[model samples]
Target: MARSFTPKVVTANRLIQGDTVWLTANGYWSSDICEAEFITDAGTAELRMIDTETQAHLVAGAYLADAVMGEKGPKPIHFREDFRTRGPSNYAHGKQAEKVEKNV
Candidate 1:
């Protein structure tokens, strides 16, 4: 039997240092940092990756997912680059921005 596609969101660490990214959908990601764009359930959410110190927002991607249920809360998501660079990134969900600066 063919498997059904499960709805999912693509999220990544705000500070990713890599050339290419692999989102949930294979072959749908971008290598050019300038072309990065968030993929959400409602559709693509335009985003920019900003340098924490310089405050320069570079075009980037963001993803969405169903809010986590009871106790679990919203699960955190990370980019393929982040995973390869630093293993699985810590989950922050709503506070991802705040947590990004802190060491994992």
Candidate 2:
């Protein structure tokens, strides 16, 4: 017996900067995980992974990541994916910095 396929999203790290990114439906990368395109079809997920890998200039280590439907959109099911969305942990920089500034 085999496990059923779960929902998935395309994810990768930016080549130059190594920032976490997700693939959107319109064929582009988004920093916000909520903007990722979720696919339930296993075939489509594999095909999408191939396409995502072609953009060597954009990303590296491209692969399909498990996701779940959230109120906003797709959300990371794994702790690793959730942590990537936080930008950085060392200090308030990148997305983290932007968030802090907006809150002030």
Candidate 3:
């Protein structure tokens, strides 16, 4: 069964350099160009990357569900198949993949 999109709010420690972030629900987060924005019945709500200190808005992309927060704020989410290839993956793919993999 296809899952319904739930409105969510999440935060990140920081967005990667030269990457865009988005407003998942209320807080801020970073996502790749392929996963940033979505057109909903409400309107076009984009995943906007911003500088933590400067508050500058970055580029937008598609929405990613795996990149969500847990009970703790800004907790990492494993959203891609590659990351999950070996058991319950803890790695966040893309730029964060290497660091996460090493730690795991």
Candidate 3 lDDT over residue span 1-104, tens digit each? 54455433222323334332344333334342123233232222233322233443332332333334334333234444223222233555445443222110
Residue 98 lDDT, candidate 1, scale 0-100: 28
In model 1, which residue pairs have backbone atoms overlapping below 3 Å?
37-61, 38-61, 38-62
Which candidate, 1 or 3, has the higher lDDT?
3
Better of 1 and 2 by TM-score: 2
What are the per-residue Cα lDDT tens digits for candidate 1 across 29-73?
433222233233332322221221232132234433322222422
* TM value for model 3: 0.27
Candidate 3 local lDDT, residue 44 = 24
Q: Report the number of backbone clashes for model 3.
A: 9
TM-score of each: 0.23, 0.83, 0.27
lDDT of each model, Cα atoms only?
A: 0.31, 0.80, 0.33
- Sliding window of 10 residues with minimal summed lDDT for model 1: 47-56
- lDDT by residue (tens digit), candidate 2, 1-104: 55699999998877887777888887888877788888998888988978976788788999888899999899989987877778667887766555321100
lDDT, candidate 3, at 6: 41
Error of 3 at 68 (Å): 5.0
